[model samples]
Target: SQQGEEDPQALSIQEGENATMNCSYKTSINNLQWYRQNSGRGLVHLILIRSNEREKHSGRLRVTLDTSKKSSSLLITASRAADTASYFCATDGLNYNQGGKLIFGQGTELSVKP
Candidate 1:
């Protein structure tokens, strides 16, 4: 499986602090997307950075993609209790062998303490 795997497995931080998570994949990818899932809820798309792009930002969320390293990182600034969730990185491989499927990481469970 070329699915990405998130590092640290879990994270714990206080409200107003910053949270960072890393994802590493096995194969080439065309684009990578970050998604957040609250307990027992569906995943919500956060940001997407193409393979050609190095960095992107949306509000307080920052994403960096390093294709050369087959890795990506997600940074959430000024974290809040509401931001507590499992963060997953999904990637669409450069080749369409998977029929345009997005391989997802195991996810990093984040906890924000108020």
Candidate 2:
């Protein structure tokens, strides 16, 4: 039950604005990762936050975790039109030993207009 479901199914924003997305899971997890997909392409890893850590940051992205609530959030600062894409959260979900196979959630689609 480590499946992580993202909230706010869709988001729209202008260039230079900040975008925030949230994810909630149903069980304890070893770690969680966020990914981005542009249009018809595959997902690309943005960040990974371990259960023992509360927050992490990479480039313009910030991620936070709350084990007590089994939830996490991703924040993108100063978004650009190129940032328009689908975002997803993934976890081990009992498949950790199967070549890193992961369980993904329904994603949040973000649109950034220039």
Q: Pick the candidate with the highest TM-score.
A: 1
lDDT of 2 by residue, 42-77 (tens): 889989998899999999999999999989999999
Clashes of each: 0, 0
- lDDT (Cα atoms) of all candidates against the true structure: 0.94, 0.90
Name the 10 consecutive residues with the lowest summed lDDT in model 1.
Answer: 92-101
lDDT digits (tens) for residues 22-58 of candidate 1: 9999888899999999999999999999999999999
